[model samples]
Target chain A: MKKSIAIDMDGVIADVDQHFLNLYHSEYGVLFTKDDIAGKTEETLFPEAGAARKFAFTPGFFLTAPVMEGAVEAVKKLMETYEVYIVSAAMEFPLSLTEKHEWLRLNFPFISWRNIVFCGDKSIINTDYMIDDHLKNLDNFKGKTLMFHSFHNVNYNHHQRVNNWDEVIKLLVEEA
Target chain B: MKKSIAIDMDGVIADVDQHFLNLYHSEYGVLFTKDDIAGKTEETLFPEAGAARKFAFTPGFFLTAPVMEGAVEAVKKLMETYEVYIVSAAMEFPLSLTEKHEWLRLNFPFISWRNIVFCGDKSIINTDYMIDDHLKNLDNFKGKTLMFHSFHNVNYNHHQRVNNWDEVIKLLVEEA
Candidate 1:
């Protein structure tokens, strides 16, 4: 069997809190910044938003945000031996998902768009390894979980903590 | 405008060569396997296997092969905005690329079977981004380029080589 890696999108690949804040400002008439969202609970930010607040948990949030540091390099290394999959909670249309795959293709051509997965329940993505920033996701992930340090998730530690692609590659490659 | 991500099947996601090689070895007199067909050049491997080679390159190649890693993630990411398209080159008829897409949906549960593109030339994809393993396809791709790494391509270093999902996430986040 081949080694597989499933990475999260939001805080791991991009700083999606600002995008969510912007989205909330437009969608639910709320205002917040990345700094304000960090370490804060959902109820604290959007006491009235309810389900709309859950939109931040979706893959589209990160898919539409800016890039994070060393994200590209980390994905490149994982693709060499493992079947890299993007298991996110985005529930939008297939067309939008396809566009993000194309963007990844253009910027990181070596990664295969075919293996990408866009779903809410990541537990279904049965893979050998996973890298995620959400403590909830890391807690529930069925595979060997690697904890990616997030700006707000610094306190959520336990599973292996990796700061960059170098550390991630070292952990994954060392196993091989 | 929204970001776009173009995906190719066959060798990128499905092992069409292996599918055909197995079929040929079992049906015809050909005795090639994935290892025999993957690393070697066409001239060295198929001096007498022209018809079989052509069949393999055609759409019949996507018969029941698996999706590569991180394909689901990347697709979900791009699907956030742009029209996610499956631009593939397959056999003309009943060996329909649509069938391959149907199979893909069953495995992925993320991409829609209808969003598939089963054409010969991706030049019409005019997409903002394209992900394909074929080096020749680089000429046909518009916008940025993301090259999938193959074992045969040991020295295949280009401006945009994405061997893993880290590279893919990095590229998408940067572009978004």
Candidate 2:
């Protein structure tokens, strides 16, 4: 039987950091490099409180976010080795649900709609392995977890870390 | 710790058959009674091929679905006895994602966004019990399953069947 793996959307495959940076530049008229967020949380990326959530709730926020570098190729490769499911904690921002679905359809066209999930919590998820940026999601999953490295989650070290999709491919595919 | 229960949205709580009947009436100048779909699948509710799917894909189809009779009261009562989560397999119809979220917010206002789940498959769900109309969903659930009554699922008998919201309250709430 093929092993099932759950993959997170935002920081892992969607490159939410780049999205935040772009949105911040467009909203504030000031461009900031990745260094601005080094070892800092996502919330701090915006000067004002709740700006991260405000952007998340925006109509086109999730739809227009750039995909992570090497994500499409790496995920397609991972699909050949295991059952890949895109799991996003998206019910919090109701607007993001459809946008995320459409975004995935546009970017990861090979992934079937049957393998996509949008939920409020991740503890309900059951899979053989999970790749996510948040510890909240990884901690509850009763399976192998690969923590995708992000500025916000740099302090978290309970799970094996993958810095990028190439690292993901090396650990789950090339090394398999 | 409270035991969690996953509840299906469409045929289980949303009265989708009634919505279809109403749409068929408006679309074709003739009212469709419940007897019209007795022992028939949801796909055959409309005379034309794919009409049911067309209605489902329509923008307001999910948002306008009426809550099943007594569902609010019964579900609220159940919530007092168990942790309730609304789980809908909605990824196949991307448009339904946001609509379902809005529908739940309007009808089941007490349900937190943190407890709503929109997903493609029920097999990934881990809950103590599940109440759903489709066998495809209930069959994959690892815990206790309550089969909500629907014309399309009348013949399925693998799980405990609850004919209505009152029956659901009786079985899960009063019995508890």
lDDT per residue as tens, model 2, A13-63 = 999888888998889897877777767775676678777778888889999
Per-model i-RMS: 12.7, 0.8
- Candidate 1 per-residue lDDT, tens place, A76-163, comes to 7777777776655443333334444544555556654455554434533456788887777777766799887655576666788887
lDDT of each: 0.61, 0.88
User: Candidates' TM-scores?
Assistant: 0.42, 0.95
How much does candidate 1 score in TM-score?
Answer: 0.42
Write down the worst ten-residue block by lDDT for model 1 chain B. B89-98
lDDT per residue for candidate 2 within B47-122, as digits (tens), equals 7878778888888999999999999998899888798999999988888887899999999999998899898887
Q: Interface root mean square deviation for model 1, in Å?
A: 12.7
